[model samples]
Each structure stands twice: as structure tokens, then as C-alpha cells.
Target: MEKLIKIISNRAVLIVLLILIQLGVLFAIVFRFQNYFVYFYTFYLLISSAVIIKIINSRSNPAYKIAWIIPIMLIPIFGTVIYLVFGRVRFSNKEKMKMAMVQERERMANESTVAKTTIDDGNPNAIIQSNYLSKHGEASLFEHTTSEYYPLGEEAFKAMIEDLEKAEKYIFMEYFIVHEGEMWDTILEIMVRKAKEGVDVRFIYDDFGCLFTLPHGYDKKLRDQGIKCCVFNQFIPVLSPIFNNRNHRKITVIDGKVAYTGGINLADEYINRIERFGHWKDNSIKVEGEAAWGFSLLFLSMWDFVNSTESNIEEFIPEYAPGELPENDGYYQPYVDSPFDRETVGMNVYLNLINRATEYVYFTTPYLVIDNLLMEALCNAAKGGVDVRIITPHIPDKWYVHAVTKSNYAQLIEAGVKIYEYTPGFIHSKTCVVDGLYATVGTVNLDYRSLFLHFECGVWMYKTNGVDAVLQDHMEIEKLSQQISLEQAKNVSFPKKVVRACLSVFAPLL
Candidate 1:
């Protein structure tokens, strides 16, 4: 009875029930007005045609277009309605205008403090990448920056707490998840103390992502503690296309001098305090020096978007006196991606790394659902004598996602790409290391939702300590992971194969 009540009161369950009720009402109205069926069919046909044209014209992945078209061809009336309601990317005009305003504000901020990007003439490939990000992603590279990699969430959490305690100017945290547990409780104590000390402590968390973990009035509670908090893109009771674009980036900036970003979130499970998935494995990186300014800008941009207030971005810019800066070692370029922007910075960065690799490419991600572009890129790199390797989860947090991930194994294995599953448990780390010289670490995942739909961010490193650390961690994790032989991939059982095939067709939608 207790389990039944829990299910009845669950937010996800309630949302599904509401959607079903709406669908039922629509069907009833259609049936009751049967005599006007001819007019309704004509309207449906016109809408379907218009939708088909729009999908073709829009600059979306070819696979996504086919996925939507298949169902539309099968059931025109319902499909057309669903496509307009969900498939259309340009759903919110207000959101588009707001994002434009935010970008303009950022541009003005950058103009105030013009930091010239210095290129390492020795590493031509790295120079190419930095230029690409600067041109398309609107991010500049920094030469005087250093980084430290944490192979586990606990390690990152320790470093994060240390940095939080040292914040004398401001502390900005933007994350997708924040559960009220041992991890957050400890952090909250620090943040509240910092806020009371006259430090500007602000936080941004996604509404739908934390719907189950946080209480409804949690933002108010945080504000009561003198911490400025806002929920990003608040979830509505009715269905809408805006929900597709989630704030998936995890970032924390302290005093505009140090920053952090990666798969780790503010929750106990992330640090393995309370194990839900067996031995939760993850990674994070701490960046110090000039590049930290980029992350600070990223956080402020989102904060402005949600609060409708333009901030003086220059106020937070780091002023590193002589000898206060970290050693000028390697190149560091921190960049952000958004669904609001037509460019796919995260995906392009991954693709560029894969294409430029001469020796090897290694990556670790929680989910492996990818499109043809990424699949082909990995396969081609492997086929061209590059050692392409990927590590996914053995004990999955989502069974359906695991099934879809497995569906693509055969093609990759056949192309000489090595696929491995972390044997101990789920690997939630989002990292990519190529040729031991280039790398990226952040919240971006190797899946359709992350690549093309969600708002994400990462740091592209060249010959930095971060690159070497990423390669070292990849090697260490590879030992604990079990490789999937090509024969094993080919020998999937018939029933499971059928289920996977069906799931793969809709994987993009998932």
C-alpha cells in the first residue's frame, strides 16, 4: 500500500496521467464531431505537408528528419499534431529573443575586457581547434592556465569544497541536479557561511532535473539563507517544446580565479556516499587562472537569462597581480553550447578531435546513443589505423538506455573500434583524450539529447596537465573495464536484438 501511494503521488506519474487525460479529451471531441471529418482531414493533410517541408528545410540531422517522417507517414492527423507540438525546434519566439539579448549582453561584456588569445605555434592542430571555437563558439583561449584532473567524484568534491571555502569575491554554481543529502548539506553550510560574509553567492539549478530530488519551496529556502538562487526553465504542468532544451551544464566558479566543470553534480550518489548504482565512477577537473573567466561568463549569462537582469560581467573579471597567476603552461579554451544557438559546439569539438587523431582516441560517457555523423567519424578514425576506444557502463542506471547503447556495438566493433563496459558499475564520466596531447572534460555526453538538444559546456585542452591527466585516467579505467569482443557483439540473442533494433529507431527521440 505504501508503494502504491508513492507511485500515485510521484510527479512523473501525475504528469503522464495529465497528458493522457488531455489526449482522451481530444479523441472524444474528434469522435463527437465526426460529421466534420472531411474538413478535419483536409486540415490535417495541409499541416502534415507543411511540417514535412519544414523538417526538410531545417538544418537538423538527417537521421532526426527520417525518424519524425516515418510516423507522420503512418498516421497523418496525430503525427502532424505531435510534430508541431514537440518536433518543431522553433517553438518559443520569446526564448529566441531572450537568448539573442543575452548574447548581445555577453558580447558587450567581452568588449569591455578584451583578452587576446595567444596561439601556441608549435601545436598547429591545437591552434586549429582554438580558432574554431573562437570563430563559432564565441570563446577565447587562455595560455596562462593550469588544470588538475580528479578520477573520482569524491576527489572532485574535496577540491570543490576547498575552493568554495576560499571564495572571497563571489561563488557561482550552476548544475543540473542538487539533492538534499550529506553532500549538499555540507556544501550548503559552506555557501551560507560565505554568503553571510558579504560574498556574492549565487546558484542556478534546472527545475525538471531536480523535480524529484528537491522540495517545491527549496529555492525560497535557499534565498532565506541569503543565497541568491533561481530555477532555470521552470517546468510547466502542460506539455511544451521548451522542455526539450534542458540546462545540462555543470559549472562552479569561485572569485573568477578558479572554476570546475564535469559530470559530478551536488548529490550524495555522485560522490558515492549513498550508493544507488554500484561504485559510481565519475571525473571532474579544476581550472585555475585566466580561463576561469570564461566559465564565470558562462554562469553569468545563464543567470541573466533566468532573472531578466543584465549584469556587469567585467565586475567579476579576475585581476591577477604579478606572480599571482598560475604558470603559463598549455592552451586552455573553455566553451559553452546551447540549443538556442544553431551551432553544435560540443558535437563539433568531439568530431574534430576524432578526425584529427593520428594515433588514438579514447572517450568515456554514460550514454552511447549517437547519430550517423558521430558513428561514421569514430568508425572512419578506427579504420584509418587510429585506436578508437570508448568506455560505457556495465551496470546501467537506465536499462532502456543501456539496450539502445548496445545496439550500436556491432557496427563499431566491425570497424575496429574497441568498446568496453566498466565492470564494477556505471561510468558517468564525460571525457575525451586523443593522442595524449588533446582532451576535453565536461557535462556534455555522447548522446542525441546532449549533442543536439541540451545546453552544455566543456574545456578544450592542448598539451596541458589536463590532457595528460585525462589520458592517465583513461588508461587506469581501461584496466578495470572489460572489452566487448567483435564476436560477442555479433552473437546478441535474437529476442534482445529485436528489442534493441526497435529501441534504436527511436533512440534519437529518447
Candidate 2:
């Protein structure tokens, strides 16, 4: 009886049941009025036609448009309605106003006139990418910042726990997934203890991302322990495109003095306490010094946006004392990407690095599913004599996504780009290193979801120790991975090829 009750009360289960019920009623109404359906059929066609026109004319990706166009044209009954519900939502006037305010607050928080660092001493490639991000992506370049790169999630976890122990002012954590296991338990223990000691602790977890990992009332439970918790975009039974906009960021800030961000989540799978897909692999970068200020304001802005309350963000603005500033390790700029800005910051950053590579470019991503533009850039770089290499997972967490990832291999391999699959297990790290001088490590996958739909973040480095560390890690992983040749990549079965073709049609949605 208890198991049955738990299943019935599961939040994800209840939402699915409610949506199914609504669909049933709608279909029943249509069938019951079949004699008068001739009038409605024309109306539905008009709606679908209008939606197709809007999609074609909108600033959406061409492949994304084709994905929806085929379906709406074929099934005119419910296709238009579904498209409206799951389509990419443009920034509304209200959203624009709120986001503008948040951006302004972020600017004011980092308004210190710390002289910008010069990159002419090293490579000019860093200067071009850094200037692009500063001018358009709102990522400010900083010196006097020290950074360390961890090639594994567990190592970064240990570092984060140590930093958490030293928090005197506040702690901010935002993650996509927070499963209740040893990983989260260890972190929560520290967060709760700090809260008891008068440290302000704030946590934000995405509702959709943690739907199955955590209980629905997890936020309330945290609040009861004196830890402030806000669930990002609470999942409701109603279908709306707003639910698709997820906060897919992993960030931990300690008193605005230290921070960490990468692909690791607060889950056992991330740290490999227990693995779902062979040995789980990930990476992270630790930032100390004034650059941690970037992550601090990023958290506060989202806090204000969710609560609909304008906070006195100046209160949390970090000011680094001259003695407190670390040695000039190198240039560090941690930036975030949002759907509202009409800028795909993560994808563009990747493009810039690939385009500007002099010797080689390396990437470690779980998914290789990409649009034609990105695919073309990879091919162009490889065909231009740049040694381009990518490492994806051998043991996939999702079979369908792995299939899509493999579907991309043959095309890239044909263009002389090397593709390798991790032999031991899944590689969930999102990292890119170019010419041994520039690198970015964070939570942006190569799929459309991470590139265009989700809110993402990463740290761009130039002439930093972190860059060398990331390049070394990539080289080591390449040794442990299996390279796919043109023959192997093109050896798919006939039926499987058909399946891949169909899946590719909807790759934008995937």
C-alpha cells in the first residue's frame, strides 16, 4: 500500500497523468462531433498554416523550422497546438525589462576600475575572443585571479567542500541536478552547518532537471533548516513553453572569494560514488580572486529575477583588498549565456576557438549532436590542417542521444576530423582547448538544447595554468579512447540508417 501511494503521489507521475487526461478529453470531444468535424478541419489547417508561416519567418534555426514544419503539415489536428506549447519563447516586454535591470545590476557590481589585462604579450587570439565576450556577452576580463583545473569531478568536489568550510560571509549554489546521495548529502551537511553559524546560504535547483532526482518538497525541507532555497521554474500540470527554459548551470560560490563551474552536478553519478554508465567522467575549474565576482552577481541576478524582488545587490558586491588579490595568474573571464539575449554565447565561443586555432583544437563532450553551421566549422578547421579532435562517451546514459551523436561521426570523419569514444565509460565533460593557449570548461553540451535553449556558463582562459591543465587532460583522455575511422562510422545497418535519418530530422527538438 505504501509503495502504491508513493507512486500515485510522485510529482512527475501526477503531471504525466494530468496531461494524458487532458489529451483524452480533447480527442473524445473531436470524435464525438465527427459529423460536424468538416468545419473544424479547415480551421485546424489554417492554424497550422499560420504557424508554419510564423516559424519560417521567425529568427529560429533553419533546421529547427524544418523539424516543426514536417510534423505540423502532416498532422494538422494537434500539431499546431503542440508546436505552440513547446516552441521557443521570445523574450516578452516584461522579461526584457527585468533582464535589463539584472544586467545593469551585474554591471554595477563589477564596476571596479581594475585595469584590464593586456594579451599582446601572448597570443592575439585571446584578445579577439576576450574583446568579443566583453563587448557583447557581458563577461568582463580580469587579472589578479588564480584558477585551477580539475580533470575529475571528485577532485573538484573535494576542493569545493574545503572552500565551503572557509565561507565566512555567504554561500550560493545553483545546479541542474541534486540527487539525494552521498554527493549531495556531504555538501548539504556543510551548507546546513554554515547556516547555523550565521552564514547566508542560498540554493537554486531546476525543477525539471531534479524532477526524478529529488522530492517535490525538497525546497521546503531546505527552508525549514534555515537555508534559503528557491526552485527554478516549478513544474506545473499545464503545458507551456516557459517550462522548456531550464537553468542548466552548475555553480558554487563561497563568500565571493572562490567559485567552481563545469559539468559536475550534485549527484552520485557525477562523482562516481555509484555509476549508471560505466565510469562517469567530468571536469571543473576552480576560480579564486576578483574573478569570483562574476559568479556572485550571476547568482544574485537570478535570485532577484525568480523572487520578483529587486535586491540591493550592492550589498553582495565583492571588493578585493590589495593584499587579498592573488598573484596575476592569467586572464579569466567567466561568462553566462541566456535564451533571452538572442545570443548563443557558448556555441559562438566554441566557434571562435575552433576558427582561430593555429596548431590543434580539442573537445570533450557527451553529445556531438550539432547543427550544420557548427558541423561546417569543425570540418573547415579540420580540412584547413588543424588537428581537430573530439571525445564522446563509449557507454551512453541515453541510447537515442548516443545514436544521434554517432550519426554525426561519419560526416566529421570524412572531413579529416578525428572522433574518439571513451573506452572506460561515459565522458560528460564540456571542455575545449585551442593552440595550448585558450580553453573553456563548463556545462554547455554540443546539442541544440545546451547551445540555444538552456542557460549555460563557462570560464574562458588565456595564458592561464588552467589552459595547460585542460589541454593535458584532453591529451590523456585521447590515449584511453578509441578512434573511429571512416569505415566504422559508415557501417550502420540499413534500418538503423533510416532511423537515424528520421531522428536527425527532429535533432533540433532532441
Question: What overall lDDT, based on C-alpha atoms, would model 1 receive against the true structure?
Answer: 0.88
Q: List TM-scores for all candidates, in order.
A: 0.96, 0.97
Per-residue lDDT tens digits for candidate 2, residues 218-334, read 999999998999988888887678876899999999988898999999999888999799988898899998788778877887888777777676566667766988998878998
Question: Could you say which candidate leads in lDDT?
Answer: 1
Q: What is the lDDT of residue 440 in candidate 2?
A: 94
In TM-score terms, candidate 2 sits at 0.97
Task: Evaluate residue 143 in candidate 2 and report its C-alpha lDDT on the 0 to 100 scale.
Answer: 80
Could you tell me the TM-score of candidate 1?
Answer: 0.96
Q: Report the Cα lDDT for candidate 2.
A: 0.88
